[model samples]
Target: MYKNINIFTDGSCISNPGPGGYAAILQYYQYEKIFSQGFFYTTNNRMELMAAIIALESLKENCNIIITTDSKYLKEGITKWIINWQHSKWLCSNKKPVKNIDLWKRLNITLTNHNIHWIWVKGHTGHIYNEKCDKLARYAATNPTYNDIGYI
Candidate 1:
């Protein structure tokens, strides 16, 4: 038997280099789980990348994971561009530095063990799981008490 799953992820930052949060929701069969966290200082892109990395890391092994995200940068990086980026030592088209190289590296390592299908979705379009993740991430970034409530 195989377990097919869909995961939605997003991240929020109050300001660039400010408070940040990341969230991911995983759905498998009849079970679902939400993971979220807050950081004292970060950026939205970082959170977006982190959510994807965290979700992939949570997978046990060899699972089919369809990762839905709103960030085009993330979807493109993980699904289309990471291979070339890795080959080029993480340089951009202009041969300039790649932003968030650390997170990209982490995401690459975490994703190596799973079969992940990256999907891009429009943000704030009322997708249930995606909305949930966004809400969690925003709340985490704003509310100190709620920071990193469920994510380990």
Candidate 2:
């Protein structure tokens, strides 16, 4: 039988391109693991993508994973839009390059190793794990300790 893993992720930014952070909660059975980090300067969308990437990368082996996020952008991009984007060599409908291509590429790679089901949850809608992740991301955004290498 395959293992089932539940993951909740969230991201926050102080401003549109200000201090930002991402958080992930991985739950397997009764044990839970958390991952979170902050960047000195970044956008909320980048953080949202990072949260999913970090959570998937943390898995040591292939498993059935249900990743829950509050970002529709994150969910739709990975589950749907990436296909078209990849077919176009990472170009958008406007024939422009996609933003956060680096993170998207990384997440795409990490996904190959597992069975992932993406889920979107409404933010601040009384979801316990989602709320915790939101808090973690907000706290990290307010107190970043690292530079966002991907930020230009």
Candidate 3:
């Protein structure tokens, strides 16, 4: 039987394209693992996608996962738009290349290994794990330690 995992994620940016960070909390039964990282230059959406991607990639084996996030962009893009994007060779409705395609591609690849269900929560709405992820992401954003290679 596959282990069931729950992941909560959030991201923050000091500015639209400034210091940013992403955080993910992975829970299995009563055990929890938290991961967060700051980047010197990035966008909030990128950070949001990174949080989910990193969390999925961290799993050691195939498992059933339910990912919770506050970003509609992340949830919608992955669940609703990615199929169209892939069919159009990564172009959006405007015929423009998709933003953060690098991260999107990475996320798509990571997703192939597991069964995932996505849940969306409103930000800062007092949800326990969401609140914790927000605080962790905000703290990491203020103390960036690495470069966002895709952004800079």
- TM-scores, in order shown? 0.88, 0.97, 0.97
Better of 1 and 3 by TM-score: 3
lDDT of the structure predicted as candidate 3? 0.94
What is the per-residue lDDT of model 1 for residues 39-117, given as tens digits with 9 covering 90 to 100? 8777889889988888778877677778999999899888788888888889988898678888888888887656778
What TM-score does model 3 achieve against the real structure?
Answer: 0.97
Highest lDDT among the candidates is held by which one? 3
lDDT for model 2 comes to 0.92
Give the Å error, residue 55, model 2: 1.0
Residue pairs with clashing backbones, model 3: none
Off by over 4 Å in 3: none
Better candidate number, 1 or 2, judged by TM-score = 2
Ranking by TM-score: 3, 2, 1
Model 1 earns a TM-score of 0.88
lDDT of each: 0.82, 0.92, 0.94
Per-residue error for 104 in candidate 3, Å, reads 0.4
Runs of candidate 2 exceeding 4 Å displacement = none
Model 1: pairs clashing at backbone N, Cα or C within 3 Å: none
Q: For residue 70, what is the lDDT in candidate 2?
A: 95
